[model samples]
Target chain A: MVFTTIVNCVRARGPDEFWRKRRIFKLAAHYIGRRRNCYTVAIKIVHRALVYATKGRQLRKQDITELRNARIIAGCEQHGLNFNDLREGLLRCNIMLNRKTLADLAAWEPYSFKALTDIAKQKTKEDGFGSVKDLQAPVGVITRGMSK
Target chain B: MSVLKRVQQWATFARIWHVYDATWQNPFQSAELLKKYLMGIHKPIYHPMNDCGDHVIVINSLDIALPGNEWAKRVYFHHTGYPGGATWTLAWELHRKDPTMILKKAVYNSMDGNLQRRYTMERLHIFPDGNVPPELMGNVSNQIRQIRPMPKRLDHYTKEEVEKFPKIIDYPKDYILR
Candidate 1:
């Protein structure tokens, strides 16, 4: 309930001392060397690792987005279409596709992507988009006017 | 896996044979297009570590077009590791020696220099002309569209179509014949 002397009172931290260090040790369990066993060392390393983990979460999303963009660009180049033109044309035609789905279509569904590119080209040609002024209109893309 | 699932898996992983007609197409541009198929980057399930590349049969490599003066200016350099072994061959000269070399080199250089490149290239069968072996041709189920439209030469136009084309003005009957 009370320390008999001032020295003993100052020396005592709490009954939960071992548990406090144990938590840090657990986080560093996989770490090699004294870092995994020593409480002070483990705590410092764990703090740095936690910071990296936090930053990595954001980086992972950016990496995926960049990869999807690269894949889409590669697909566009193959069909001789500008990446921006494809996106603009699709938007004008009311085809709402995000990068993730577009990337998937570009990769797995080659024929579908081909049709999309054709549609994009047709839309760009119809609208007389500046970038596509020289682009030849793709044939056989049946739009509403054609259907009627 | 069950029989249907097993078959589906096989179909998913099956190597597709793609035919590309390189007539009047730029080798560098064609290389960029073909690299995706060769590396299987077109597959939704593509992973750099996974081998999902397809087989591409490039035909009419001899007809590849070089933009500007690339035929004369482009050089293929090689060295034999001797004191004076460095040799630079003009594109046209190289093309004359090997009709398929330019396209092959284009495809090879287009891909990232990695351990997988050489092996991936082996899957690409290029012919100088559309003379693929029947066995190889039989495997082809897909034809990659040419990047640029082939231009029709004046001589190749049909007489009736040429005559039907709208004329802006009739040359004066008395206009001095060149």
Candidate 2:
């Protein structure tokens, strides 16, 4: 019943298949000799690398938090207000500005940040917070009135 | 809110710095506060699975208060997983050995028992005193109000300030000097 020509199983699959795997193998090119060349070793190395990549994403998130914390702290120190006082003051004024935005404003837009700080200082004063009492009021051009 | 506005909000992940003065603060209360910050429960975007917790920097941990003789009554136990390996340490003794251990342990115990707890604990920075490392100093953005007022130190009052302080009692000249 089987009267067909002989088929070759050991032949190359195709350029598409070859390149598809080669792409990942290329990623492992910098790997040690056999890990880069041998397809079997290359796949294993690639899999491990991918796992590291996934973990790297989580590490990146933590790094961002640390960076943001640093920026906010620097901003608070420059403005002579503790981070908590600034946040509380802002919260009382119904301004829910986040630390990232505040830090950005502190770095790039000094005038805008100053206005926010003044608002916070005023709110802290009204709330009877002892910490902000000693902070000097922003100099020049009052933006918001001193009222609750 | 519009979808675009919501997306914009989500895009800006702002991490907050929460400061706590552990001076005379009950460990349980401080632990609760730390948990709130560590779990991001205080924020509107809090989710159990998401890592949205804020950073907490605790100062004066050495001065943390233990209510009603807990310093002597409370005990921390540990074991080495072997025969006769069990060890018990009193709260005061532990504090004396490591000033930050009590608060750290309280907060650690309060956190959820899961893989994410270690990651959350990394955000918590504890200092024995008000002096923080210069590297971490920039991260402080806000302070949580102290639960109890810190007792005044004698050196804090100047000679003139002390003279102006109100006298609670006027002792008679005949009273024997201590």
Model 2: residue A11 alpha-carbon error in angstroms? 54
Question: lDDT of candidate 1 vs native?
Answer: 0.89
The CAPRI-style docking tier of model 1 reads incorrect
Query: How high is each candidate's TM-score?
Result: 0.63, 0.51
Give the CAPRI class of candidate 2.
Answer: incorrect
Q: Could you give candidate 1's per-residue lDDT for residues B86-135 as a string of tens digits? A: 99999999999999999999999999899999999999999999889999
lDDT of 2 by residue, B1-178 (tens): 9999798667545677888889889988889878878777554344456677889999899888899989999999999999999999999999999999999989999987999899999988999999998767787778877766788898998999988889999899899988
Error of 2 at B76 (Å): 0.3
Instruction: Give the DockQ (2 decimals) of all models.
Output: 0.21, 0.02
Clashing pairs in 1: A107-B42
lDDT of 1 at A46: 100
Q: Give the C-alpha miss distance for residue A19 in model 2, angstroms.
A: 51
Positional deviation of B106 in candidate 1, in angstroms? 1.0
